[model samples]
Target: MSTNNYPFQLGQDQSRRKFIYNFTKAAGVATLLTSPVISHADSFFVPPAPVTVGEVMDMFINQVPGAPFNSTVDTLKAGNRDIQVTGIVTTMFATIEVIRKSIALGANFIIAHEPTFYNHQDQTAWLANDEVYRYKADLLQQHNIAVWRNHDYIHSINPDGVRMGLLKQLGWQSYYNPVATNVLMLPTTSLSSLIDHLKQKLFIDKVRYIGDLKQNCQKILLMPGAAGGTRQIQAMGKEKPDVLICGEIQEWETAEYVRDAQAKGQKLSLIVLGHIASEEPGSEFMANWLKEKLPGMKITHLLSNNSLSFL
Candidate 1:
């Protein structure tokens, strides 16, 4: 959607004009506003009063360069990028339920930290002919919703948005290092007790562990949202952390390595908090940033339904 066909009337009054001007300035796209307001006949391609989808996407990527995922501006389907996004909604995953919630909040632009379509890449290859995928994609088209993934951008930002959220939620901001996105020191506690505390505090059900709870955990390495491969796992071991709190891990890789450490009698622990729970905080941070950047625009946050059910 371009500036010409903006949905909201920008030339109504002085206040409206000021609002648009300030919003464009905050978005760092004031140069695009040569004309006070522009309109287009393509109702499907509604642009936000003062901002464009490209600008919004650019703002997010530029602000959060360290995000873990990638985004694509594709025109594969009709009405995909035709929406004029007034407000922005941030979420871990842009599932159907989340999309519905965004629409109810009057936010047509969605900035998702994870994939909208099920996979990590948000690709629709397998769903190219799938009935359910097609229906979901069509629903988005009908509503004129424009979805963008801000994963990689957020991760690339110094300190990493996800890690920052985790630290904020844990009240460990003082311990966090902005340059390395690592914690200097955490309160000393038993591995088991720390696990229990995290479960109770986060109110999460799927917290899994891979160490002797009785061990005293003086130092812990935390990597939210998926453990790295064997090489990185080995490096983490060198750090001599009593425990490693990671979001998720492949069953055969980090998970098994932790088991091996246990077998070898190393007093190391691994806590798996699932990917969604690990990354949820970042979306909340995104919402706060949106509020700061676009003061006039209404902002809302939608959370993904828990994707895993354990026996």
Candidate 2:
């Protein structure tokens, strides 16, 4: 579904990322520990233990100990948490179309990458009088659908699940650095070629870049979200990638840093893939990852198109 369906109101979630060493181990234990016991036909009677939407999400995202982003923001946005999920839809955003689509597909659980409500934390106290909010909330209640945002936790997943998904989409599985999840080592290619590759593979319409098109780029620092200027610069300086591929950045912030770096002839380059384009794949990655993790439930990745366009 399009972002426009949610009207002009939008939320920007701040994901504080912490590196964990063993995500697979953590996630696996979480699944086994949190999983609802399966009923075997041979057994006399093993009643299916209720596995609610919140339970599954908590298992998946809480793989890391002591999550910095509290449950007040990560908790359920709509519907009851006790409602058993028939299936799950993991998307970049739970837009109006996605909510209806999930319900149509008989899926009651939606694990979204962004806020279901207009605010970053999905605070409904302020939107109590908003008709759009009422309609959306009422629709979710009518369908008995529950929404949960996987913003901070997913990014904080040991291997940085978000980056893992992008690597899978970009076909750079072997290029991932074990110690540093954000860095990438690739064969030398021009800036334009890399951009073209991103557009073709990621299906992006437009991208913003800083550096000459003909400039040769090899080492890539993939920062897929707006991690702010200081972090962005620190990463760039540390890795010193030929090109920095990122999701979103303020023009006055990291963008200006790259611009000034280029003036100094450091040959540093930058590409902004917009917030949705960069992190969207992570949610899609999450869908695939959930299949093995949540055996009883079918998980689908609902693609959210970039909310911006260029004339």
Candidate 3:
């Protein structure tokens, strides 16, 4: 892509803020190190070590506990984990455009909420000969950009990072379920009206649903990300929400299940929000959470827009 096609730039305030932040950070670190040294063996480990990509990754991983999906996919996707980060950019997916934007913002690290290699596991065997994949990989290598997928852990976190981000975006924190967060009780509205509201809020014009436009929907079950067929169906069955807001739906499974249920006169609705729009907000939220964790860094959020577009 041409530099002319680059979509964003570092604003003046951000530049000035970053400069002041670095100056203050230097002073604080100097003071900490110069203060009286502790004599205990544990305390003698020193203070204020430089941060690296691996350190950041470990910080995130430690936030979620127990049996979350742990795999190589969650590890660093590109560049060196040992490299000291200049800045971080959180996004839904690490597309070429987002990568370009990160480079322009002087961010050497990217924390993505989705896969970079077009698949869940990001296996490259099938993409070995693909020219498109090669070009993107080449760009990553050339820039020495580090990318880490924060999917499994983010979802597994106590408050669920994606839900927290989306709620903040939608301003639905007041309506959030106190007992079961997955279940939301909305004010009664027609199915079509709710769809319209989602369309405007999420910037999604179209949606696939399993209910009549005139159907009344109040209770909603929000299942973001590809939670798979079993989990989606099970949630709807257990909660019996009037509508189920999902990131994705399988044609023959969950969608069909909902369709058959609706045909049987069951009060159920299903709205597909697509994968990117559903989880991207959480990645945008990650930028803020990361800012709090590693302050004084030039952290910014670059939206990894949906890959496909409607005509």
Candidate 4:
């Protein structure tokens, strides 16, 4: 073979022994086999690009339609946005236990679905002197963990990310109404059985409901998280669902409406799934989404369990 065809030039005068020794020692058999010249490779393996907290936030913002809203509660609650994220944890809330777990997992970014402080806007000025607030804040600061609320943006998605997740968990995709994502035309079943189904799927020991056990149910209106009493009632009125499954409800509001509607011989009902339990699946969905979007990055979903327990 002509030496010109080879990547390296070989001299005829060189002994076969000397040629083999030079090739093995200088080029190395392994290197020659793996090298781009001999292997005809386009590129070598490279690690996934290092991602920052802000970049991941931007990915969500960019994907969400009508994002960069005029005002949003989806703000970073702790740590610097510029910090390089070692790992990510998505949760319903950044509770003390969740924060500790994130730290233990070596995750520096926490994408939470609700307020970190006790209120909607996460106003810390009022909580400045509060002991619990101070402790939670200090813990995040100590471990350099960043908590970002993803409330508005996640809900702003067309089908609503939280609702999509909940529907997926319920195995009701076939029953979902695309035009009215919250509405589901389930196969006719008793209200009690529906509640049982929800409890089983949601892994909840019990659920608070306002309806007779034997009442037949077909239409369902699922409003996860605290969509407020007025919104829930209005949806109930408009959709005229046989049952309204929601996160949390004030005793004097939607629950009362359901009671009165039932009194009037209306086929109406309500099931409260608690706020944390209702939205935790959405956080899990978010983590799963990020796993696909940023392959090779560590993303985990941890539940921020409900504080209430039956006596």
The candidate scoring highest on lDDT is 4
Whole-model Cα lDDT of every candidate shown, in order: 0.66, 0.76, 0.76, 0.80
State each candidate's clash count.
20, 0, 0, 0
lDDT of 1 by residue, 1-311 (tens): 11222222223332222111111222322223233466533223222257666666666666553432344432122234445566777787778887777777767788877766777656688889998899889878878888877766676677688788777765567778654454345656666567655654444755888776667776667788754677448757678678888877887888788888889888778888888877877887778877777655667766674777889
Candidate 4 structure quality by residue, lDDT tens digits, 1-311: 11122111223323333111111111112221256457564443344468889999999989889788889999999987798988888888899998988888888999999999989999999989999999999999998889999998988887778888887776776777788888887767777667767776677778899988777888889888898999999999998999999999888999999999999999898899998778877887788788778766667788787788986
List residue ranges in candidate 1 displaced over 4 A: 1-49, 64-82
The candidate, 1 or 3, that scores higher on TM-score is: 3
Q: What lDDT does candidate 3 reach at residue 283?
A: 80
- Higher lDDT: candidate 1 or 4? 4
- The TM-scores of all predictions, comma-separated, are 0.77, 0.81, 0.81, 0.85
Candidate 4 residue-wise lDDT at 71: 95
> lDDT tens string, model 3, 44-81?
22333468998888888877877435454686788878
Better of 1 and 2 by lDDT: 2
Collision count of model 4:
0
Query: What TM-score, to 2 decimals, does candidate 2 have?
Result: 0.81
lDDT of 3: 0.76
Residue-wise C-alpha lDDT for candidate 2, range 1-311, written one tens digit per residue: 11122211112111222111112211121122232475432323333345887678767856765664645466678877678877788888899988987887778998888888878878789889999999999999898998888777887777888988888777788989888888887777778778877765666778989998888777899988678778998999998989889888878988888888988889899988888888888887788787777654556777767666788
Give per-model CA RMSD: 13.4, 10.8, 9.6, 18.3
Scored by lDDT, model 4 comes in at 0.80
